[model samples]
Target: MRRGARYRWVVLAVATFTQAASGFFVQGIGAMGIQLQRELGLSTAQLGLLVSAAQFVPLVGLLVAGELLDRCDERWVVGAGAGVVAVALGAGALVPGYAGLLAVLLVVGAGYSTVQPGGSKSVASWFHASQRGFAMGVRQAGLPLGAAFASAVLPLVAGAFGWRAALVTGGFVALLGAVAFMTLYRRPPGRAVLPRARTPRGVRMRLLREPAMVRTMLAGAGLISVQCGVGILTVLYLHEVAHAGAGAAALVLVATQGTGVLGRIALAAWSDRVGVGRQRAVVVCMVAVVAGMAVLLTPAGRSAAVACCAFLWLGFFGFGWYGPWVAQVTESAPPDRTGFALGLAMSVNQIAIVAVPPLLGLLKDLSGGFAPAWGLLIAMTLAALVASVRTGGARRSADPAPDRDEVACPS
Candidate 1:
């Protein structure tokens, strides 16, 4: 019994660490962008395309990874995924030209997408329905935590040793994560431990057939837009508008990501207590993001300070929806289809990610500032609000989740 309890915590830790490590591959790119462009003599469009290549290819890989995750052993799925990501990070150290950078980042994106479904599936398998929100929240916190680590360290590292050294160092850390996951990660070892709805075949078809699932998937894309778009733009805004140092801009991402970690825990816990549906949490976050964008658009100095506060708030709420969203989908999915449902969510989300980056970049190119970028984001958020309301805005009030005691997973 003691050993079993120990392994449970181990599993949770592995999931969280795996998430953090995988995120670092591209999460540090925003910081790296300023340096890379100056060193490589690249244009905004070229830089945007390079980042977009890394950002977008994951969607294709995710479609496959998601399906494979549902059908395969969770251990092998996550382990292999992490291994590929580690390799991609190491390869990132060798990107000598834009083409090489683009190619390597594509691989990194593919590998990183593999981690999410595998991790989400593991959480769904290990925890009870009541405790899922908290479990998933803890797991999802990895995204921002890992990004924060990158934001905090990479700039200083690059400043001291050059970008190559920074990439190699972070690459080594990611590789170590792959090794750690392989060593420590495991799931309960029997068919009986599986969720009732999980099945290998025909699962994807079933998930898409649900109206609620379709709306949720679309809503998730909007949620991701808020996170990804803000993350991509924040550095440029800080640099160009506020004339802040790259190091400080990097640190702003760190602070924003740090606040996101808190937001993930708080909003996830709140969702369980308030019986608020994931859609509601997403809507509230969209509202916060719009406000953050407004503040970000204001002129420099004090406005930058105000925008910083808004960024922190946006990070908190904007990132908070992920845990509950995963829980809701996994728990409510038809028996024998959690893998498919989760995978579909991941894939659809990857598509959103692919679409957003370049679109924002293009808008910036056309408008000559981030005002157009923020305006576009506001439009996307508004669209998400409509989708959320149509799907289940009222569901939060309709379905009161079990109390906190009931929602806490057992160690």
Candidate 2:
């Protein structure tokens, strides 16, 4: 399949669905946070740990899964990974205890490591440079949209039939994703199934040595940190610092999330239409996120309306940054090493995802104010922006034909 082929759209839709389904169970943990706390006699930190446990394994699992993708077909790699997610989460419903549930979510994270990079590689296979940004954007959007949907429904399922039922429901959704991807996804017509390109050590060194990859990882870490800050701190800042009502502060978080979804799609599409290439698009998002985070430090941020707008701005570029950044990673990947490159870059990002929120929270606790946390994020982002500028254009010749993988096939 090629971008012009109708089946490419099918690939995009199925890949997007798989991304959503893969995350549905994990996202549900947050949705039913209170219920999990009450039924399990858990502390708030333990409840937070469930979400972390579900994500923690991906820190290493993604690289392993990415290597497998290069050797095998995505239909099988992603399908099997999704299948693992389905089975683990389904089995989790019967665990009935906190420790067991934590272990199960760990397994879910292991399985889920495949969905992100695998899905990106699949889309990159079908869509050329001209359209890859838009396709990647749409595919990335599925994650938040799916989480939002789970936020709405899984809580109800947990409320009515108990949390076990919610786990089962999420497992079913993941199963559907596995089946859909395996049943519908196809390789771009002329693209060959590549062999193991190199050893894991070799791959790691090669990618790390690439200037573009380094820049991508740096920017990704910084931007995702801002994303984590936006999600974890927005409501708290509005409620405690701005003197806004709890419900109103929460509504602002909702707007931030909703705007994030739109931003993912819109920003990625902009990269597609612009002639400046994906790297510039990613830098633009970085600039915007930096601007948004900096505003939180000023007196103007104390106004409820202004704080709400700032978070929305942060949400748009912070959460929206992934699409173009991922595109840049895939595009800059070594020949036939897109999956590993994507995985490696994202695993680096996972470090930020795991660390930033807690670090920011710790900063807030120690300082007795949110300003320190906000300033920390601004510094992180600005540092990355500066590093990116300093390292710019060093890899352009090596990265000349990013669309070299674009293959034409008969419809």
Candidate 3:
């Protein structure tokens, strides 16, 4: 009977699957980017803008989706989101021009936003406080894991059947996963589940005034600056700078993503032991990111292997901060306000993602390479580190006892 209660594992698994599905669905764009540019006759700026369009829609979606997750059934809300993403991707595959592509990605991104907060809230509900970081790590790792899967497969699919065919294939896979999640995904059985609490209408204003939360959110956004810059440009950098073949560049993405999976899980789980708060851990991670960018600055030569190794290290730390940082955010949030806090944080993240890439890409365009652009990223990481230092020392809180009586074991 002790072992049988492990249905929580099933819940975690499906949630991971859904998050990973989103990754596979979006990562396809990056993998097929070069092909899409050629087929559509897009400039580098235009290509970056298309990728940004897919990323930008999630900001609005996240704001609204968080509210929905707080008030609605997870299964139904997520199921509907899944359907929207599937249809959006299917339409995206059929787009005849850049405008049509942007419109489709907007719809797809809205669908993408629903799964994240819903999955996160569900994980927080099912796990006890002590187990929260690992649970979140498992779920967060899905993003990179899914991206890795997509990066590996999508290029080949496009090579074989054209980019449109690859997009349609990805859409079909997402739709199938959505149907499965709707069918098999169950809330933990027999818990006396309470509706997620509501924040007052003025809570947004109140939260904006929160120095600690504000500092943390700003710090988090800064760290993600590196991720946004790297995600969009790393492939181009490899192709253009290192003169790597398409297969080789895709492998670099795989390496970057694969290490990030470990980094996300390992860093979060490490925070559980190291006795440092999430803020300091993030500062330390960003410092490593700065060093990774420095390594990239070195000339591409026999040392290129060293640069790849540096990227793996950088990738590990670059995207790894999210799990632990988000764990802290959720842990700090008032129970009723978890959804709002997370929503606002994601909104801030989306803004960084949307706002930063184009500026950095423009730097690349004007400078005729990425040296100046990467320098700007290093500056962003330094800014994040400063933000981390500005947040004062932590307050201690006792762990609450696990709610063993909350739910019966699933039979």
Candidate 4:
């Protein structure tokens, strides 16, 4: 039991680092907004498209990865996916034009799709319900932690050496993640000794109909949109509107990601203590994000001190919201099909991530300011929050979840 406990921590560490390493580049791209725009002569929309390109393939790829995870071990599936990201970014580093970079990122997205569900399921398997929320938060916090490091470092590399060098930096880190995962990750002790079985057909379809799933989808869509908006625009907004220097703006972006890291861990830890009512925590995040964006939409946010505080607030709630939300998903998921549930929830989120960055950028480009873009996200999040609240009540008034045997694995 002690060996297993220690090994579970090892699993958590590897899973967390892999999450960070795999996402380092894409998540940090927003901080590189100034460099990419200058070196490549990219418009706001074009810069946003870079993130979109990386996210595009994940839309369908996540669903496929979910199926793969239910059938195979996470070690191979996740490691191979991270390897693809490392190669795509590293090799594509020297591409001469923007179009080629986008093509390369599409491949990166394909590889990254496997990592999310794979890592989540791996942690879920090792940790039980009592500790899972906190464990998942620590694992999920890797995204922002990696992004924060990348935000600080990648921008400097892009500014000093060139954007291509930054690509190499991200890829090298991803390679480390791939190697670590393949070498270190193992299924829970007993499960590895048993024969593997496939998750039954229609698992994904049935998951879509669950009340918990509806909340997950709604919450994920809204918060993911906010997360992308924050990443792609924070540096640019600070530099352009607030008249901060390049380095100062980058630092602010780093701070935002830093807060995001704290939010993920703290909120998740909170959920672990709260038991089954995690959605209330998500609602609080939504309300907080809405408040921060409302500030940004007004003149009060024009002050540097105020703007910084608002972004930090947005970072905390907007990014932090996922910990509890994802915990809720795992909490509600059928034990055997946690991977499929995670994949299904995340795939729904991929739609917003792929679509939001470019659209928000376009909104900024068209309106010639950040207000319109902020307003749109404010609207999106508010809508989702309202829907979540209504659905929660209706769900309580409705019938209970069906038995697990109805969705059991193949015998």
Top of the candidates by TM-score: 4
Where model 4 places Cα greater than 4 Å from the true spot, the runs are 193-201, 396-411
- Higher-lDDT candidate among 3 and 4? 4
- Best candidate (score: lDDT): 4
lDDT of 2: 0.80
TM-score-sorted candidate list, best first = 4, 3, 1, 2
Q: Candidate 4, which ten residues in sequence have the lowest lDDT sum?
A: 402-411
Candidate 3 accuracy as lDDT: 0.74
Report the lDDT of model 2 for residue 128: 68
Residues 327-390, candidate 4: write the lDDT tens digits: 7887667766667788889988989998898999999999999999999999999999988887
- Can you tell me which runs of candidate 1 are displaced by over 4 Å? 189-203, 298-302, 393-411
RMSD to native, candidate 3: 2.6
**Prediction 4 global C-alpha lDDT:** 0.86
Candidate 2 stretches greater than 4 Å from native: 1-4, 28-48, 96-98, 158-163, 197-200, 235-252, 297-304, 364-369, 397-403, 406-411
Q: What is the TM-score (0 to 1) of candidate 1?
A: 0.89
Error of 4 at 207 (Å): 1.1
What TM-score does candidate 2 get on C-alpha atoms? 0.88
From the highest lDDT down, the ranking of the candidates is 4, 2, 3, 1
lDDT of each residue in 153-220, candidate 3, tens digit only: 88888888887777687788778768867876676666444576555678888766666677678777
